[model samples]
Target: MTAALASENLASADAAIHLGNVSKVFGKEGADGSYRAVDRLNLDVARGQMLAILGKTGCGKSTIFNMIAGLTEPTSGTVRVSGKNPFSDFDAFRGKMAIVFQSDRLLPWRTAIQNVQLGLEMLDAPPADRKDTARQWLIKLGLGGHEDDFPHALSGGMRQRVSIARAFATNADILLCDEPFSALDESTAGKLRAEFVRLVKENGKTAVFITHSISEALEIGDRIVVLKRPAMIAYDVSFNTDTSAEERTLIRGRIGEVLAA
Candidate 1:
């Protein structure tokens, strides 16, 4: 095997995610009823690489995530994390991965810091330690002052920041995000994206992010894997650049061509 493949296997044995020829079909049987949301998808994400999956709506990008997250199983083939099947070892697998859904699923009654502490609580960390850790992450995400505020009291962007902080605080090796910045204003989204990219890189965490925004994909991903209609990988492009106005424009043009084609 090549070095990359070998490394992928090792990471899979440790904390990686692998999907082999995975397919998800919805609808009942017997009469033109199968809807293939994901078809023969194959992916190997290493221990610390930030990978992006980009596609239009109904293209099965989120379906792929659902399978990996163990929220849903594939109709065929396999999905594994850290050498363990998510379905068979759901609790163990969940410890190795954290997900931030598009919606900020924060508890309405919980304070921001308490919401961030929830993951640690699930892990059974001591309350003091968990609260301290949660506070640090909230501060990291610029939510220190609002830590006592409830979810409803915060703005949408602030709530999303708390959600992101909570996910990172889990200290899971793999982070899965589904259109996390979609609801934020452009400027706030841009800043959050940059900060998130920095955090992932600094922590050496593996990530599979689903986003419709081409610019967001290019900005955060080490590799952008585009899912065309019917759920096949249409383009897999590597991006290596510091975020800049010129780079953004150039990447936008390239991604436009790929989507247009």
Candidate 2:
């Protein structure tokens, strides 16, 4: 590798995402008035780490996701993914990141496998190779037999699975999810959550997701950050992989207390 390329690779390996004293606001502050969505917030998702941001409704959870995904810019401070400004350098993340949303945003015109292949099409992959990759990912996500089905023909949970399949098919180094399973029934959501966590861990993928469900965050997050109004971190914790039932119960109680406060 050239010296510059090697240096860039090293930087990408350092931290998957970082938000340094970031804040965002909308509208005019004095005349039209404005609201601060996030207030001098700072956060980090380390390389290969899965961090969950848990908060109540209207607490700027989606606002934060927007900043991280580079759909919006910070009003002050900085948002960096792999050491690059995600908004200004948006093209830098084309192949390195993918996002899965709560609702399955499948194109109705495309079949399940075709939907998964869309990202590859943007990357200029040959049709046959894209087909193979999409099929493998669908199989991995337990949608093997449904590849030819249209979105309307599948259940809600099945469509969500296809969404996840599309995100994973690109083999992106980073994944950003916004309450991806929130629309499913309890049982279906539980199963998909387990599958999501498994694939992420097994692939050593770095991920950031936001959720309102405390239990879901506890189940999937290696690190959890609780945010309140204006999006300040109220509780930050790291969980051990081997945590006992009793300890989890205690942790749950503590998180509840903070959320209620």
Candidate 3:
């Protein structure tokens, strides 16, 4: 592997999410119709780390996301979450991981609190516990009074907040987000991003946020992994809140160059 790939595959024994030499091919491999979306990609997300994966559309971002989410298996290599294979051990992850999709994905008939309780319901949590957990998350996400409102009655931003509250209500240790805030207006998205980062930190959750937006990645990730076609890592960098603005600007420029190439 190249030095960049080596860095991309940095060893982390305590990694919350690990993908080693993972490749995903749709259709028959080496056949005419086969498509390799991910090619020997390697990544390690340490516990409590918020990783932003940036790439253009059709760069296999969703393929990688599905693999990590245990929705799809890789054609080769291994995908492990908390030291277990995510694909083979899907059921073992129940209540251990949660996802926030691009769309709010709330059921129109369900109230905000009811939507938030969905995950808890899947976990078979007690009725009282589910209600309490859902209510707490809604309040934390600034939807206290809106909890009883149905999805159609809420604004776009409020619906997304309910989705986020749902994800956290499960008390999952890992979060997989696919441009969850991308649909909202910039101001709303920015606020949600800040709230997301804060909640992830405060809850000590490891998150992999997939986005095509460089600005979103820069704002949310302590570690940013920029991928090229076939989902190979092109650049890997880490920065924190204490990072200098000048340095961040330089990193942003570098990422732009990589993507432009």
Candidate 4:
């Protein structure tokens, strides 16, 4: 078999997240008023892989994210996480999947550590255990002394650090990030991106990060999938830390060409 075909089969057999012939429509199918956000999109992400999905605005990136998060049901075909329907078995994934959004989304009234403990609270973890886990995550994210500060008292980067701490505190196996660092200044975003990639690798988490920036995707993803309008995969490539800079530049140029098309 072709190497690409063999790899595809391996992904299908052991994917942590799978979308098979998945399509999502906002209104009735085959109707004039309806809008199809995804068109028979099939994707497979293996365990512990970091997949960056690059797309233009209104290309249904968020729609695909929602479907994977179990917040939206597909119009046809199947969406599976660890071999189960995330939408139908939403409760089963409560502590198994965590999301980090563009905004920090921290509670105003809660202190940094408390906010980090939010997910653990849902799991009914003991208060002491929750506090310890939250504190450790905060420390790891460089928020060591700021754990007592409220959201309003922190800077944007610091607040997003707390958000990252919260997501990791749950120890979820799968992390879905929707441009989590997009709102920060370039310097801060760059720092956080490096830290995010490190944490994901260290924790052995499967991540699907959606981004509009090709540079960010290149920096964060081991495998990058660029999408066109209607959420179709236009280009897919995989690279690693061992990949040479020249190859990366070529990949970037190819991605730019695809996006421009």
* Candidate number achieving the greatest TM-score relative to the actual structure: 4
Ranking of models by TM-score:
4, 3, 2, 1
TM for every model, in the order presented, reads 0.90, 0.93, 0.95, 0.96
The TM-score of predicted model 1 comes to 0.90
- lDDT order of candidates, top first: 4, 3, 2, 1
Stretches of candidate 2 exceeding 4 Å from the true structure:
1-13
Clash count for each candidate, listed in order shown: 0, 0, 0, 0
Give the alpha carbon lDDT tens digit for every residue of 196-258 in model 4: 999999999999999999999999999999999899999999998899999999999999999
- Candidate 4 stretches greater than 4 Å from native: 1-10
Q: Is candidate 2 or candidate 4 better by lDDT?
A: 4
lDDT of 1: 0.87
Higher-ranked by TM-score: 1 or 3: 3
Residue-level lDDT of model 2, residues 1-261, one tens digit each, is 999878655654577798878999987654557899899997877888889999989899999999999999999988899888999999888878999998999999999999999999988889999999999999998888999999999999999999999999888999999999999999999999999999999999999988999999998898899999999999998887798889888888988998999
Question: What lDDT does each candidate get?
Answer: 0.87, 0.91, 0.94, 0.95
| Pairs of residues at least 3 apart in sequence or in different chains that clash in candidate 3 | none
| Model 1 lDDT tens row, 1-261 | 999989766655654788878878897533496788888987878777899999888888888888888889888898998777887678986447899989899999899999999999999999999999999999999997898999999999999999999999989888999999899999999999999999999998999999998878887898888888778888776656555778667767877787777
Model 3 CA RMSD to the hidden true structure, in angstroms? 2.9
Considering lDDT, which of the candidate structures 1 and 4 is the better prediction for this target? 4
